[model samples]
Target chain A: MGDISTEQLAEECLAIVTENAGKKKIKAGDLQKAMAAKYGDQVDRKDVKAAIKELIDSGKCVYGYFGGSSIELPHVEGSAND
Target chain B: MADDLKIPLLEELEKGPWPSFVSDIKSVADRKPMAADLLRQLEKSYEDKRGYWKHGGLVGVMGYGGGVIGRYSALPEDFPGVSHFHTVRVNQPSGWFYTTDALREIVDIWDEHGSGLFNMHGSTGDMVLLGTRTEELEPTFRALTEKGWDLGGSGSDMRTPSCCVGPARCQNACYDTMDMTYQLTQNYQDELHRPMFNYKFKMKMSGCPNDCTAAIARSDMAVIGIWKDDIKVNQEEFAKYLDDGFNVQEFVVEKCPTRCITVEGKEINIDNSNCVKCMHCINRMPKALAVGDDKGFAINIGAKAPIVEGALFGSVIVPFMKIEDGDYEELYDFIDRMWEFWDEHGTARERIGEFIERVSLATFLEGIEMEPSPKMVKAPRDNPYIFYEEYFAEEDEGEGEGEE
Candidate 1:
């Protein structure tokens, strides 16, 4: 298995959050499981975390860590202020 | 005698705090009789509410149709200066910076040709020679051009683009604004003189965040400087500001619209997390705040006088684009695209912005081959949230298949 790039990680993360839209609280474990299914041995815990960070920064995903990490698909607002 | 005689005006008690233009005119009037008579007539007109002379004619310096604006009267004897009372707009050099020699050359030329009296800067940033003759227009323009000077905007053409002193004098400048202004002015000379458009076009440029030239309000086209990176905060300087009795609670932390900055003890921390790069903090503390290394400009569109439509504020079009080598091809391409679009769809008197609003920003974007950002909206209050309706439709189709 090969190491995944940040761009690949970001795409995977976007797919996961987008796929599970409106689902009650997607967890870090769920993301890791999804990554494992897609990349098999290529994906790691650190790669998933970095990808999630990038997604949040780009306003593509919104997440809140309440003890167990839960993330959700972020809606792209029409206006910049939103 | 009473009807023929003119009144010697007395100085007013409260003529405001500023220095008197009347006095300045009087000083020049003493040296030149023609200027003296012109000033006296102007003063009389002010008192009588009637003009001493009518204005119109082709006036230039020597061999050209520009430079000196000739205000001639057929009744020249009645208005002695009327024949020679032409306003000369001396072509100001690019960036308008002058050496002592250049100043002397222009002043000497004006004094010799017509009035010693002059307005240092005219409405068009040229030196306005206030009184010359209709015939002198050609000679005056010829002489000035011969001396390596020329005419500026007069009719419906492109007005000279003025800019604040960029990298030369200002620390905040991201590019050579002055050079760019001159380049555009020189490149589009024909457009600056001919009245082809429905109305006049104005261009203005500013160095950085601080718009010294007031380009935002004054010009049809304004190029403002901006950067595209995280704000640079000097921790040591910020600490000093805090130590020097600066109001961290009120000014820095509380004043931030984004609530991005927090002060803990003497150290100030900015959560790059929320910093919008609005330059508010940088404006507050010039020494402490620096912009990010990634430099570029944000292009704004549709800023013009409210002629056809009601007054409209400029809207941000290209939020961020790189500027390099003073050769802004992207800007030129954008302008060309805008012109083509507006000229095709616009009525005789309609402006580009109004035309765009009439059509749509979406159409404009498609024409220009740029994707609409989330920031782009029809109005200021449009909803931003996007749920995948297409994806939902696909999901519904899958569910119907399961039902089958």
Candidate 2:
């Protein structure tokens, strides 16, 4: 679970975001910590942060303001998804 | 400003004893066609007792979650000028200080791109660019960012942090409020631009306890300047104040919050241990008193307006945290600890203060791993009655008796 490349982590992040698209609100910190717990210290928070950014920049995940700012599929209309 | 426009309601609004926003809006209405539409729509609202603006869906710059507040005119066919009037929130400079050139650069762009109406500031401290069309967001954003400007926070994101005029112009300043505000803005760009909290979190910094910026009431996290040592005293200046007929006993001495001051003949002695640092004495006698050399900030938490709970003033968290130049790890780490807890525990739309209230302050303190301090509470509960609980208990006891 540890020592994965940023691209790998980003893929995993996308999987988590995609899985939670309409099920629950996925925040950056929630995904970051979930990754940190799954992967060991070899996977630093910096990697998860970078991976999230990578996912966002690549248009795989878009931030939508669902009660809180959340990562969701581009067009999922969560509450006030602005 | 519109020569032939008939607006009886707006004209009546301009008739009051005070300066009117109606007049101000008209003063600049000629600059943009939208202002006339805005006035006409406002008049219709006054007549019909209903608003004509509705929030639009999902409008913002690419790759950013927050910042753009989307507004759409409900009467789009009637007011096409305001059909897509979205507000752009530009992060104001630290301490809201701006040079003439910088101010000119912003207004000049707005003059070309969107509505000429700009709020010098919003409550959250953004220079609110009031009205703009959907097509112009990127251009206006690009124009501003090209001049090294950034957007402020909106939605559930950490709204932009604001600070009082600190060491720049104030004598009572105990910390570099501007530096703290700017560094937090830069360091937490993700938090400010992205939504991670259950609700909006605000951070406000004030140079001293006079609370010129109202951080205690307005922000979720408040960093206020304070001192640890005795307030510096100028005996010569103190004597001069009395000799000049200033009423020390009637004002300063009697008004000391803790009654820590004692004036005997010409000598003034303050009980430094009990000094609450409320600044009353210092304010009354500025030349004769100065704040101590040992300065730091007091971090308070959980302040907001009435939402999901009653309003709350910030409560003390870290009584004293020394902020060194170019270093902010301690402060950010502590804030994030509380934020993480709130993110996990708070309900949707619940502010941190409301969370603290629901879970009890002790639980919140434990969750954040901070030692509970005596200073955290404003005062002990002098009225600790459990009215509703007792009433419920009595009703439970009378459950078999039948409904009264």
Candidate 3:
């Protein structure tokens, strides 16, 4: 929405997921909140969702349900989804 | 899969007077291999006296977090086809009205990668496809999405909003229940798909107090239709009903909790101010009585089953709010205020109803920035609630009196 396509936004989200992969479980809600902070608090939740969907649809990311739900890098070692 | 399989335990369930899911699954089993395996697994459960399905870890389509219920068979070594039988929840159309083509498409897709078992509508108002492998999650999602179908909520997400058939069938509906339900579902797609809250939240709408959907006893948020003006009455129709041997005492008079309706000779009169909008009079004498012209909705929050404590019926949050067809900013803003507070304070798996109980309704009201209303409570408290503002004000006044 902010002059960036959903694909580009998805790339940013992918980086956030990868960066926070080991430290914390970055959930879909967490991803939007984190990206909003990264982009000077300017991010639409719908746009973020579109980006996240692109990540999943493209097989760059995957959803894991551990108590609740969270997004993660695909095909990672010791991952539960496999 | 076998040419001749014997499921003695499951076959007994098909004998009941009520329509049986056992029979329904058997029909599906004839086509889908996984469904056949599912029947076998279920039969084993009845024989063994224990369920084989276990779910804890995550399994869903590539991007989406909700709609898929991840379940793995504990007895996978015995039944391989039903091993990773996760459930896919397809968001049902508002009022559950679906065309033949839409249903055929769903059935076709399920035949491809699913167990072919379905719940006509789950508790959360989604058309639930019972079983599928984890690997098929993406493909299943793709097929549904391509055909303009979307998934419903699950796992700490906002459950799909449901409504009784309003303008579609019932004439008592003061507001358009389907439109409101669909609008909220579409607008809150992000909240519905993701775990926005710490726990699950359910929203159910009813067109009138008859509450065919049972929104009052079940959902976290309930939108029930109401009218501000007097009940519309036709005296001639009222006489006609009574003259036709309609039992006035047993049907209309007794059914009204408030006892506002009075039968004078042949005509029935309603004390509009005292009328509670129970809709019994209107239901019994549809030709004679009707809902008022000034229509709106009565909003209630925090109704759920016993979990943290005993069951809590929804308490009225807003007595009435005009729900404009296109603009619902007031309603959305009120919900936003509630969510802001609940999201900040509620612990994991704690419901909004439980939160109100834990913090007391007074504290909950303050948290949500809602003013105290007489309509919000069933009766006056035995010991009146000591709100923070009133308590502080009393203390401040006491200081001056003490000094004197």
Cα lDDT of model 1 by residue, B150-172, tens digit: 77655334565677778777777
Clashing pairs in 3: A65-B58
Q: State the displacement of the C-alpha of residue B192, model 2, in Å, after optimal TM-score superposition.
A: 1.3
Q: Mind giving the per-residue lDDT tens digits that candidate 3 earns over B266-314?
A: 8788877677777778888899999888777777788887865677778
Candidate 2: residue B265 Cα off by (Å): 1.4
Query: How does residue B249 of candidate 1 score in lDDT?
Result: 79
Q: What is the DockQ of each candidate?
A: 0.01, 0.27, 0.29
- Which is the leading candidate under lDDT? 2
Error of 1 at B25 (Å): 1.4
Rank the models by TM-score, top first.
Answer: 2, 3, 1
Candidate 2 residue pairs that clash: none
- Tens digits of per-residue lDDT for model 2 on B1-404? 88755779878988869988788778877767788788888888998999988765466777676788878888888877788788889999889999999999999988788888888789989999888887788899899999999889987779999999999999999999999999999999988886666789999999988878888888999888888777899999999999999999999998876788999888899987677788889989999999888787787788888866788878877767777676889888998899888876887788988889899999999999986644565411211101122244355345321111
